[model samples]
Target: MSLVRLSIKGISYSQTQNGAYALILNEVDGERKLPIVIGAFEAQSIAIALEKEIRPPRPLTHDLFKTFADRFDIVVKQVIIHKLVDGVFYSSMICERDKIEEIIDARTSDAIALALRFDAPIFTYKNILDKAGIYLNMSSEDKSDSEESDDILSTPETFGNTSSDEEIKNTYAKYTLAELNDLMDQAVQDEDYEKAAKIRDEITKRES
Candidate 1:
């Protein structure tokens, strides 16, 4: 299987699945996109990594991993989203330490997050992309913040894409950082990482 380079197109909340978010990846040389469903905590971690200006008061799990990897001289050379089974995407981190390289299994979300922090490239198998990739009617790069908040992406029949109206219409903008943190804790306790991610986005927006 040949590898295709990919870049983060955007992240959007899943209207069809509560607490699920879509991590959109675009092929660097093609219009095909791979949208992987991920948990809210992973979404928040990825978004935080992308937003170079927004620093969290504490390190997130991905951040901690990045710090530890850096300290030990384990550099992530690249991340590969290699498989899709039952709608779940599997990824591997291609890391090197002491002039030796190894591949480590990881959730697609976490792999991408660390890739961003390490400035490592991301890739996916061409066969996998051909299986799950779709050509959106609209460009992923053109999606606005409001559109992301709203749910407007579609994948053609070849790809299995969920469909539904946008859920959780409330904007967390009105909540203060402390309130958002409390809500984040509650969301975690309730295992509602999606809501926690939305709150995290709102907090990041305020800081930006």
Candidate 2:
């Protein structure tokens, strides 16, 4: 199978599942994006790693793993998202130490978070991308229209795994698009990404 390199796009809260997030991966040389649902802690860990400016007072679990690996001289070479079964992604980490290499199984979210810390490249089989990737239309002339299209295209796929947790209620339904935009900006300024994501979803819903 041919491998395609991928890069972090961003993370957003799942609209349909409580405490779940969608991790978006962009094909490095293509237009498609791979969205995988991940848990809250993993999402936050990956977010912090991506931001590079927010340092947690204590090392998060992934951070501890990186520290431990450094102490042992283990180096992460790359990450491979090797499989997709029932809406879940499976990944492997290529690590090397003392001129020997090892492959370690990892959750897609965890693998990605560690990849950011280690500056490791991420790759997935072309077949996997064909099966799960989504494309965004970027040729539109209107900027807002293009962004709206992107949000619509990047929605999370639950794949029958959503639990019984009641979805977050829509309190912004009454607000106009203009007001919602202001609220979204405020949410982002407050660093409430989950709230910002929900607002963005509401705006997208209205736009669509």
Best by lDDT: 2
Per-residue CA lDDT of model 1 for 1-208, tens digit only, reads 8999998877777665676676767789986666666777888888887778889999999889888988999999999988765445678999999999999998777888899999999998998887666544444554454245543222211112333212222455466789877886575344333444455444544564
Candidate 1: global Cα-lDDT?
0.69
Worst 10 residues of 2 by lDDT: 152-161
- Each prediction's RMSD to truth: 14.2, 9.3
Clashes (N, CA, C under 3 Å) per candidate: 0, 0
Reference-based TM-score of each model: 0.67, 0.70
Instruction: Give a tens-digit lDDT track for model 2, residues 1-208.
Output: 9999998767666666687886778899997767676778888888888877889999999999999999999999999999876445689999999999999998887898899999999999998887666554345465355345333112223322233223423476567889988886675444344455455555544664
